[model samples]
Target: MEPTILQGYELAKQLYAKHGIDVDQALRQLEKIKISVHCWQGDDVKGFLFRDQELTGGISVTGNYPGAARTPQELRMDLEEAFRLIPGKHKVNLHAIYADTQEKPDLDELEPRHFEPWVAWAREQGLGLDFNPTCFSHEKSKDGFTLSHPDPDIRKFWIEHCKASRRISAYFGEQLGQTCVTNVWVPDGYKDVPVDRMSPRIRLKESLDEVFAEPLNPAHHLDAVESKLFGIGSEAYVVGSHEFYMGYGLQNNKLICLDAGHFHPTETISNKLSSLALFAEGLLLHVSRPMRWDSDHVVVMDDELLDIGRELVRGGLLEKTHIGLDFFDASINRVAAWVIGTRNTLKALLRAFLEPVDELKKAELDGDYTARLALTEEFKAYPFGAVWDYYCASQGVPVRETWLEQVRTYEREVLSKREQAAAPAQL
Candidate 1:
């Protein structure tokens, strides 16, 4: 989608003239409206729901997960299958990969000989591919080098993967008419140090430069860069929250793909509100729901998840952005999970897009930012929570208040144990 950038600016300009609003700021902010996914599991939920809703433009996916595809070859098959099953009309990007250094990470072992043809065939079949290595596990990334890893041998491996990923990406672009966006999220940290001491980024950037060292290529264009704020385990190495800035900001080929859930551990990180501020900066979005200290479950319509949708629009991050859905249905009811999740997904998005535009129109004519903001914020919590509640209630579903209490109670117990272990014995 070309995104209504100029139109949005013109609208903002007129609204400013008519209502004395900050048209300049709105217009400036409007330049970075991105609607894309941070992560995804290939499926039809998006096509079935949001394409018609006119909310998101695409979704990101990692085809290797949720299946027995451990090796690169196995993963490629699963990847192809997932893409084929993607029953949506939006762009499909890639995210979340397994590292080679870590105990046979999927795709780490994949040679271009294997990947090149598959990605080519996928293009023939209309499946867009997001090619990159995985992080989050220490075994995968002992020393991070996006384009460059610290170990020379590992660097050699990384360089080869870069070549293959780039080739596949370029191929996808040509065949699909869309850029093969690379979201380079790596875990480049140290176990004993106060911070990620190694200059893994040095190698990472070098590798990236090498990948892009060539002249213009149609098949691949580095679209976005993703960074995270938290990690999975004690002594687990998490690259800096803004590490991608050095890599993507310096390079012309990339954009910033912000994950709202990734920034949750910080109290001051205003969730999706921050995406607006980041939007003004260059690069677009890689949308997703981060499980944050827990399993990376693809939540459908949690309070905070839906809130991210509202923030994206209100912050002007939805204008002409390359947005995608990166959700995980970690629930036992995989099919039902995908369905209700997607149903809620469209509901949340429609509320964000339709209601906000409607309110913005009314507020402009009636001079009611207070009323408009209130209405939007009121629905910010979740677009479909009420409808879901009504449906569940009508169906006589068991109340989840008790389930919620039990989970919270367990968390408290675990935290209390940890705190006692850290604290001195009581007198």
Candidate 2:
């Protein structure tokens, strides 16, 4: 783990407590600190999202937490740290765990054995749940990307999983005591479909509504929709928009999770900013980035951070944003290495926020997207640790030390399992 990030977290504690209770005031100060600490990761421009101050920043840890969690109790704590340490204003993001998502059982664990423990851990640690079940396996979504599939059994199977997860989702709200479903990303859309396509979202909505509608809602859980800026029939939205295949989901009032990274390669930065602004203004949940139009989820730095944050704040979505630090392990940071994965992304976002709006606007207007466009030079500054003094001097926020400690204990437990899973079982 980066010592600087820890120091920043510690400072967050000091500043937050300094403010007594007012969450709004404390949040603004922390935003400034976020800008400073986040920028440390890089020398040039294009800092991190977690590192950014302008956005509703949050922190997240990855892979290691899973392996560290051999037992439910241990797992709960790591997540707790994520919740407590990251702070409410900032959302703690989790990868639905591509590996875990794919870890399907034939008959033994018909239901996720870890389901109860996972939820329990989340509540104990004071963290909300965010996930993308499809990354793991479509066994549950066998009906073909949500409700579109024609198989009732497949739909039933996935619905069952949803029901089980609903229990956990409820815990996040009632027990863990969170608000939104934190980023229920369903990458359930088809790519190879022929001719015209219908709303895959409508199908997904009916399916989730069917499950959440059970008297279990209100008490048990709520569902959120993810609007990915993907494509249709091998062409862009202008040509064949990937989101067109999944845009129907956003229309649902349930909830919306906007992905910053997906805007890349597919659309322009402005388009993505507008979508998030509309979503945030409407009080929708926001997911953090690594989007490069067509690129996969990587660390948030470079131009992506600035583009996303500017739109978010300018759009007035920051106040209502339910930020999730979404990440997918890459060659640089694979799954399970929770510490680096989570911290790196957090630092990036934080840095993005720290950027002065005037300068950013000037750059945007002038189209001086040099740093905004390139990733390498933009992030060339930091060696390993990158905390700046000027950034801190201007930052101030209140921290709930007790709550922070509570979540830290949980993160340790969660990361414990991640440690255990470092090596894979023989097939």
Candidate 3:
């Protein structure tokens, strides 16, 4: 590593050691935490299965930025570039629609063979893989209903899709020797006020039961349910509301995906972690930034992000919680978005790990609220940045903003070429 980084880290270590914190131990823990990078961000949520299909499910990726990946190869290449810049080994989150196969198959007909390429790539990268069932952007879900559709046929289609997704998820785990979380998030609700919400929820419950009928080994496969408060058309009632999924997840002993953008504007998922950690079997966190709504903006080093890191570390919930990024911002350079968001997440976690938690807890227990508050605020100005810089250098990733130059070089060469080749012929 650089001499400056070493010098800074030594100073940071001494400062942290004074507070009964072990910088080396913190770095070791940070090295093991892998953040699952979302794949859809590279291509603005457009997958290989139906590239022309308009994004449904109240999900929207804004901006027409140049160099969006056009094929599975291009997407993987872009992801490789992203991973090269980001430190540590991290998993990639793939949706069902990202299936790569010679023979086209419908959602319900999806099989593990279709995702063999992803597993192979993950293996080559020494990384893990996570999956999601794409229950939106399809003809069957055109009417804004999926698992809870009143029509039994439509409901069966979604159920079969979810089941197929589980098998594929298990396949990923079996191939890579890591647990794959298969999250189910359906866009089933009404545009306006609905009188009969109970029936749809009942149907949804039955559909989920059928989807999870065939038990899969937890070591290879894990099931998770994600809930959203409201969406574009479903502004009034969202079938899989927080309350609905929380209860379902607890009763069914499944992971509950808490999306930062899926809740009300004021509510934060950080506070919910403690309660869910106690009751839920596990948790899948969709770290994101919501601008006024479920806009899915790129994550930044903000207060909420820090709080989330603090909660996860302080509550000792990292082992049971699957950390994943969920925002897709097409407005900026897509690859940079991945690096920025993933790096910021790591920084937050590192900051949390470096915290003098025992001291803070003791102060709180001893009714020394002033000391607790003072220490909490005081540590905010500590030399965590030096520690972060050292960590980045140790991981062989570009330190500070130096990574952006590589991204710019990539954009100037590879991304710009793609944009040019994709542009229509000049008159």
Candidate 4:
């Protein structure tokens, strides 16, 4: 560790100690929390199985960024680079479309063998793995209806895909010795106001029931359902709205995935955690930054992110909540996006862990809102950055913006070469 980092950490430690906060204990807690890094960021959500397919189902990755991973191997290489820069061991979140196999298989026909390479890689990296069924961006879903499609055949196909995904998720957990969460998200809705919204929701409920009919070991695998407010095509209404999934999740004992960008711009997911934590089996958070819509922009150290971390710590919900990132910014260097988002998430959690929670609770309970407000505002100026820098150095990652230079070097050597090699041959 740098002398400056040690000196700063010592000062920060003493300052925090004055407030009854144990800096070392906070670091230990931070070390144990892992953020599941989404794999789609490396390749702009364009998985290997169907490279020629257009990203449908209201999903779009803007920007013709250079060096987008063209193959599974390249994506893995980029992820390895990202993992090296990020602190601590974490899980990789995979969608079904990212299947790596010689034989081509449709989504419904996908099996555990299709994702063997991912498991093998995760094992080698000593990391955990999470999964999601790719219910969108397919021929059947081109009409913007899946799961709740009126066509029985189409609904059956998606249901089978979800079932297969659960098995694959279980395989990951069994191999990695960590429970894998298979999140289900579908873009089933109408672009215009529909007269019969009830039928689609009813069909969706039945389909989800059929999908979860098979009982899997809770220790090895868990199921989660994600809801969206609206999408590009489904502008008027989304079939899997929050109310639908929240009720279903509570009744069926499934994890409800609360995506930060999936709700109305005014609504924040931080406030929903406590209420959901009370009834839901578990929660899966898809942390992302949305600019007026579900843009899937890379996450930054913003207010909502901090509030999310604080809620997890203040409510003691870390053990039950699975933290996974969900964003893909094709406009920038993909690997750097991962490092930046993951690091910021850790920083937010660290700040929350270093808070004098007991004191704050006491102030609130004693009807001293003034002190509660005063202390929180005052603590914002504390030397939290020093503790973060020390943690990064101790975890073998670059401290602060120093990691950016390494990313630039990687772009110059590896990513730029990929772009050159992929360029059309000039006559």
Candidate 5:
């Protein structure tokens, strides 16, 4: 370890000791917490499937950065590079479309063998895997409705796809010795005002019930449902709205996914954590940054991210909450985006863990609002950067801006290769 890191850590330890905060203990706890890095970041949401079309769901990925992963091996290489830069032990979240199979199986026909390579890669890396059903960019979903589609055949197809996704998730857990979180999110809604709003939601409910009909051991797999407010074509109404999923999650004993950008712009998910944790056994968070709507921009160390970490730490819901990234940016180096986002998330969590939670709670319980507010503001000035640097050093990752140079070097050697190969024949 560097002398600067050791000196800075010792000074930070003494400062935090005054507030009854154990800096070393906080570092240990932060190391134990893992943020599931999204695999889509390496490929700009373009899965490994043989589809030649644009994004269909209400989402879009802007920018044309070079070297987007074109194969499972390439994507995994990019992910390995990203993980190398990010500190701490972490997991990777995979979409159903990323299956490494030669046969072009439709979503309904997807099986665990299709994703066997992913499980094998994850096992080799000692990573826990999470799964998501690809509910968009398909012929059936081009109409902007899936589970809630009035067409029984289309709805049935999506339901079967969801069921297949769950089975694959369970297989991942069985193979990797870790529970896989399988989240179902559908882009089912109307573009214009519909007279029969209630009917679509009812159909959606029925479809979900059918998909989850098969019972899987909770020890191996966990199920979650995600809801959205609106999308590009479905601005009028989204059948699987937050309220519907909240109700269903509570009733079905499933994890409710609260996407940061899925709700109204001003609505923050931090406030919903305590309230939902009260009713649900666990929660899954799709942590993303939305420029205007659910844009799925890369996450940063912003106040909203900090608040999320604070809420989880204050409420002691770290173990109960599943933290996963849900953003993609192709404008910059994709691997760099992954490293930046994941590192920032870990930084926010470290900040939360370093907080003197007991002191804050004591002040609140004693009705000392003045002291509580003061302590909150004062703690912000602590040497958090020092502790963060120490943590990175301990984790064998590049400290501070040193990681940026590594990314630049990798871009020169690796990401630039694709651009060179695709360049037009000069003169």
Candidate 6:
């Protein structure tokens, strides 16, 4: 053990003890909180369909950062590099489009064999997996809507795609010894006002009913429906708005996915967790940094994130919440983006665990508002960084910004070579 880390943790332990908080127990609990890292960041949402398809459905990935993973092996290698720098065991989140196969099965025809490589990779990496049904960036989805399209053929196609995704998710849980979450989010809305709004929603409900007709064991899989307020093209109305999913999830005994970026800019997801917990069996959080719109930026240790962490811990909802990151920044190094976003997420959760929740709750309940506010303010300045650094060191990962050096070395040795080989000759 490094003398500095040991000395820092020892002092931090005593500091936390004065507030009746156990630093050691907090560290242990933090280790059990796994943040699922998304795979789209490795390739700017360009999956291995081996097609020249542009992203549709109001979704887009900006910037052209060199070295985006172009193959399955490269994406896996990049993810491996990222996991090494982040502390604690985590899960890999996959999309239906990332399947590794030459057959290029349509979304409706996708089978478990399409994702066997991902399952094998997860096994080798000692990681679990989560999945999403890809309903965008394809020919069938180019009409600006799916699942609620006016045409029954298009809606049925997307329904079949979601059904296949559920089976694949169950397979992941069975093979990896963890409950895999399958989230369904379709871009079905309009850019302008429609005469009738109820028809689209009715169609969406029917489509979702068909997708969830065959139930899978809850022990092996969890079904979640995500909603969005609006997107790039669907500015006028989003069919699967939060209100729609909230009612649907509670009625169907399914998890509701609360994406941080899917709401208005002034809204925060942290405030919604407690309310959703009351009726839903569990909640799935799509943690992302939204800039004005539903722009998915890398997550940072900001106030909103801390509030989210605090809510989970205070309400005892960690066990009932599936924490996953959803962001993709192509302007910078994608691997580093993964490391930064994931580590920050873990850090926020750790800070939540370190809080003197019992003490604060008692004060609030006893009408001692002054003490509650004071303690809350004071806890913010606690020696959280010392504990975070110690946790990282104990996990055999780099402490503090030391991980950046490793990322730089990887870029020079691996990423740069790929870019150089692919660059066009200069005139």
**On lDDT, who's better, 5 or 6?**
6
Which stretches in model 4 have alpha-carbon errors above 4 Å? 423-427
Better of 1 and 4 by TM-score: 4
What local distance difference test score does each model get? 0.44, 0.39, 0.93, 0.93, 0.89, 0.92
lDDT of 5 by residue, 380-413 (tens): 8889999999999988999998998988888888
Clashing pairs in 6: none
Report the alpha-carbon TM-score of model 6 versus the true structure.
Answer: 0.98
Kindly indicate the candidate among 4 and 6 with the higher lDDT: 4
Q: Which residues of candidate 5, in runs, are more than 4 Å off? A: 422-427
Per-residue lDDT of candidate 2, residues 1-427 (tens digit): 3465556655544443442323234335435322101111111111111112221111122222133332223333333333223422332333222112234443212333334444554455444554333322234433224444446666565565556555545545565555425234444544454453544444555666665555544433445555555433222322113354234335554444455555545444434546544543233323344434333344444565545544655454555444444443323212222333344444444444443444445667888887455532443342212232222222321122233344455445543345546434312
- The C-alpha local distance difference test score for the whole of candidate 4 amounts to 0.93
Candidate 3 is scored at a TM of 0.98
Worst 10 residues of 1 by lDDT: 48-57
Stretches of model 2 off by over 4 angstroms after superposition: 1-114, 131-146, 180-184, 187-193, 199-205, 212-222, 229-251, 263-271, 274-276, 279-295, 333-427
Residue 248 of model 4 has an lDDT of 99
C-alpha TM-scores of all predictions: 0.57, 0.55, 0.98, 0.98, 0.97, 0.98
TM-score: model 4 vs. ground truth:
0.98
lDDT of 5 at 184: 92
> Candidate 2 deviates by what RMSD?
11.5
* Cα RMSDs, all models: 14.4, 11.5, 2.3, 2.3, 2.7, 2.6
What is the C-alpha lDDT profile of model 6 across 1-427, one tens digit per residue? Answer: 6999989999999999998999999998999988899999999998887336998877878998878887888889999999999998999999998988878588889988888998999999999999999999989898788999999988888999999999999999999998999999998889998788999999999999999999898888999999999998899999999999999999999999999989999899999999999989899999999998779889999999999999999999999999999998999999999999999999999999999999999999999999999999998999999999899999999999999999999998888778877533211
